[model samples]
Target: MATPGTAKRMWALDSPTFTVDKSLLLLGASGECTIPMPAFLIEHPKGLVLFDTGLVPAAATDPEGVYGPLAEHLGLSFLPEQTVDAQLEALGYKLSDIKYVIASHTHFDHTGGLYLFPDAQFYVGEGDMRFGFWPDPAGAGFFRQADIEPLRGRNVLEVPGVDHDVFGDGSVVILFTPGHTPGELSLLVRLPGRNFILTGDTVHLRDALTTIAPMPHDADTVQSLRSIRRLNLLRDSADATIWISHDPEDWAEFKHAPNCFE
Candidate 1:
């Protein structure tokens, strides 16, 4: 592995396929749509890092347990191999090797594999830790107690709503782009040549940002719109490619693990 500053290899891991109402992804859109959940592996010289964990292993055999009724509602699909452990094994790595696990939010899809990396230093946005713990009961359905239980007293870093340089080098950064959730965090990766921005539900589909429409699941639509504007500015200023994690187009454009972005 190269040093933090020199670390450049990154792999994108896809979870089992999921289908959702297109309108749920982008307001005003209709029809059923399929999307892939993605997790990223970055081999930094300082330590191996994983960004977001796809669905839990149980999603394959016991979706009701992992996702409750939402599993069927979202049409969640899972294959045994889509588990983080399986994906890491296929990539020649183990959960024990991961030094840091940066979570975008506490959504089941993103935090499913969190418990599997108990040894890794966990990180989530500032307000989200508490929000996940005691979210508004009215809409707390999204915050599963099971997902929040594993993070009880672990080594979790609550990243402030600002740009956090993971390795103290600008190579990899956590961007605070809250909207979809109280403290949703996006990612900025500066590679040797091209730069990229990982939009974690901040902008679910291209149309959401392009049309200035926020998804229905957002905690704050106004704030979501503002966040999208911020992302747009960041994209234009840095000339970074915005990779919407759930966008089918992006899933097709980016290669899965074994194939990576260097």
Candidate 2:
């Protein structure tokens, strides 16, 4: 179901993560201190597609307000130098050229740079958007109103449930993988030479995939595990490489900055 004359390419941008102190409640049973955070860019003939927007460059200097909590949690002093715009520009593309912006979920980190593509159509799970706007009290601060307010009426594609072929061709598909966030979603891309499944927080680290470690916090533990299983099955069946959005090791393995996979 892939379209003709179109090539799919993937780019892994800067990678960053937050480490939880043992004093702070342990996340998984193993109680690992570090977690991986990554962002991706998808290149196609039609236009460029960005998976989850990493931290905004501005957050590095100020590290207060909305990012204050995140900064504290991460125990980092400065943010990474590679902003989404800079990374894309290095690859010979501009923010305006990105026609579609698909977010795995509406968490602040994932949606931070969404404002850069205000004109592009955003694809998100229908339930996720609703839950983001009215998240549970405990999860309210995770969704930033400023980041998502601009996308209200423009081209917002909301998928109800199940995996959706966004382009009606198998070239791009948005798969519903909830758990980390209420309406979390992942993408399955059929590239020319290879295939990839962008596992947006469905399975954070390689350990999670192999040992079934629990994420720090999840909307539903059972749903998250089920989603991970589904992704594993799809990856094995399609022979597609699974890219976890927040895996530093995986990010280091891919082409970075100007270089991309096509």
Candidate 3:
């Protein structure tokens, strides 16, 4: 924690690279394409806040160890330096500095590094916990047992639909934007120059937001559309930027850690 009025600094962390079906990003699409798995480091005045954890480190050396066959199916790949610890170290920080972790959802890619931060307060949406405890088989192998196990009985804050104000400063707020998963969450971060809304799979790409194309893995198509519309309204109302989590185009426009948004 810095000071009460002190503004927070945000850094976009490096993530694993993977390819997925075009239709998986935008419905009714064909073929495959590359995407980035991003994590964020927020130097809040109260404490360090991390948004999502990207991929598991084991996936770097042994993809099969972390994700089983799904790792191969998605063509997941990464270097050891891209792991969360390495990314933090590259930014002149360490895993111990993180005070709170905001998980967008329980999907393998987003929650992979949670095991590394047991002492950090974990924030997640209420409904998503069920998926973590007993993942529905119909999710098409999106949620993983190994990833969810680490978060079982820790200091978990199950944020309800009302949304959560991370530091009570209205700077870094967790918005409950479901549909990608039962309790999918997004972020509303107020930086010095710009306000950013990190949409965690709430419409995998910007095109899906414009086209209102429901992703194939979306838990509820109608709810997904509503969430996208809600984000669009918020984006327009505040003139904020929406960063789609898995969109490579969005990822390309930012600087990975060691550089930051203040």
Candidate 4:
């Protein structure tokens, strides 16, 4: 059970803007190709939880090794100064202090910094781990072995169904939302005075959620829409604030590092 009156706090770690052409790739129809990617930090009574690990500094400097072809495809030229570790340190928290990490999915961008938090228990969807560790490197959803190698044999909480209560007391819950990837998931945190839902990539932008638009590269467009609807339902039920991982508008609206949710 969660501690009574537990205050939930969140911080924006990285806020990097990119062109839509570079982000959505084949999905941009209007040539309005620009978007922003933001990562979040959550503080709970149970422990410090990081929603998605943003791009590591190494990846930006050595794009060839970390980003591979994706960088070229997206036309990425620079990286953000605030890495996950640096941002956490700024808040007086170290990587080791983050006891748990919930990754919405294992895509390169989301999982790039997993190695940095080696001590944190990882929480991911069951199908995501399978998709990430597929034997075939050519597979559509395969993840780099280097990124996940350190997590081997560590504590991994795999959600089997569409939704799971992480702390029993409802302080934290992991929502399984497939579409962007086979097992993409979201996070919902119940705070002292508010609630929050971390939408991994279910709806990259607020526009997508309002219009219920599906991204072109999703595994299943229909499933993605269903997931979005589920998020809407949760939002209404909990009166929660929805945080889209890559929406620049949402990032701009939220307070940045050193300022937390609580």
Candidate 5:
């Protein structure tokens, strides 16, 4: 394999959406905002990998049923065809073709398609699954029981709170930048022409990159800030583009599936 940044490698799955207050995406911001929830698929030379599954397929018709009160609050706009499995099939791949599932974290948005990959190897940060089950407190609503329940008998390979090179060639990496959730993670993909740091809720909007701020609900504000700073350093030093996954602005910037990153 000569390397594939030229083409035929990675693609962005179409996004579903959920509307929330601007304040939800960034600290001290306001107004209602609709954001994109994108998923990614990578056809690595060695194997197939997926990053961040969007909303539950059921959410398209029954958001309230799938997500409870939170769905009503967030206002979902998902299409049945926007699901991971459907998108993969559209692209001529199958559910079983995904050899690896790299979950940026177990937030409901990122874990929706995990059930499709029970036979594939799973990768997540150390505290993520644990946090998904225990959560922060008496009623932390982000962790959905349905999302975590399916992992019971699956193969999950947790990376101890640190950065990891997924393929050993430095093409894909898992950066441990927890804050939004206890084991929140971000992905770093080094395509031949460009590099991308997929910020998985580490900083929900591009504004956070400039302000260096953490959203109000993060598990550790201090750690969140530090992670932002680290990402900034990486952005500058490596000339990497930080793709804020939920940023609507970002959704417009990249081409959806059928179109690809590299």
Candidate 6:
């Protein structure tokens, strides 16, 4: 094994913001909440890897252009500069530089930019891909046929129902975390000094971890709860920092782009 921290550098890309009823994210929660949509860029000795891709750049000017029928329901407010392409450019990198694109799931927001990295190797959960083909009606809106349609003829690796170590070095791993959808996956990054587990909507809010609150749209509430507990155990047993990718509070604290976590 290449020891921990085999990945050299990592950055959280800037992303557009979106608002939704708090109840949509957490069960029994009230009020509306605006949360940042973020994608992460990591540099491994192997090459550049992106965790998610945020929303489409065009969505900045036309939310409808991105969300279509779901635009108004989303209440998204995106800025031109918040696009992943722009943020990568600002950081002296470009979409083509990324060698690997790991989709947390087929959710439009998370895999929005997959088309940008056509040449890059793509990794996703088999279940998510299957869901894309046959989505649970409850979570159907979360998907965009266009988001995944582009994978056609491209090199894509569908991870099975277990954790996958991307580099075989114990540095960057893809955790099989489903339930939110049928195949939502999470990420694990091991730095020399510390480790991190980025929960990609495993539980949208940190509080859900303690509350054991459920997302009404989850395909399987029981499975979702199991996944949440799995995350908790992973965090404790691995002594890793758990980051809820969509939580507004998490967004505020994260060092975006020009700054990064090494």
| TM-score, ranked from best to worst | 6, 3, 5, 1, 2, 4
* Per-residue lDDT of candidate 5, residues 78-126 (tens digit): 8888888889999999899998888888888888888888899888887
**Residue pairs in clash, model 3:** none
lDDT of 3 by residue, 6-40 (tens): 23788888888889888777888888889999899
Model 2, 1-262: lDDT tens digits are 5442334777777655667553232244445455445567777767777888866657766767548666886664445466677767777788898888898998877877888888898888867877777888876866776677777887998878778876666777888988888778998887888788988877777767776655766777888889888888989877789887666567667666556667
Quote the lDDT for 31 in model 3: 82
Candidate 4 lDDT, tens digit per residue, 73-108?
665554646667666777787778988888888776
Local distance difference test, candidate 3: 0.85
**Cα lDDT computed for each candidate against the true fold:** 0.84, 0.74, 0.85, 0.74, 0.83, 0.85
Question: Between 3 and 5, whose lDDT is larger?
Answer: 3
Candidate 4, lDDT over the whole model: 0.74
Task: Name the runs in model 3 displaced over 4 angstroms.
Answer: 1-7
lDDT of 6 by residue, 45-69 (tens): 8999999888877878888866886
* Residue-level lDDT tens digits of model 1 in 1-262: 5443535788888577779888877888998889888898887778888889878777788998767788888888788887888889998887799999989998777888899988899889989978888887655777776876898889999998787999887778899988888889998887765678898888888888788888877887888999899999999976789999999998888777878877
- For each candidate in turn, the TM-score is 0.94, 0.87, 0.95, 0.87, 0.94, 0.95
Worst 10 residues of 1 by lDDT: 1-10
lDDT of model number 1: 0.84
* Clash counts for all predictions: 1, 2, 0, 7, 0, 0
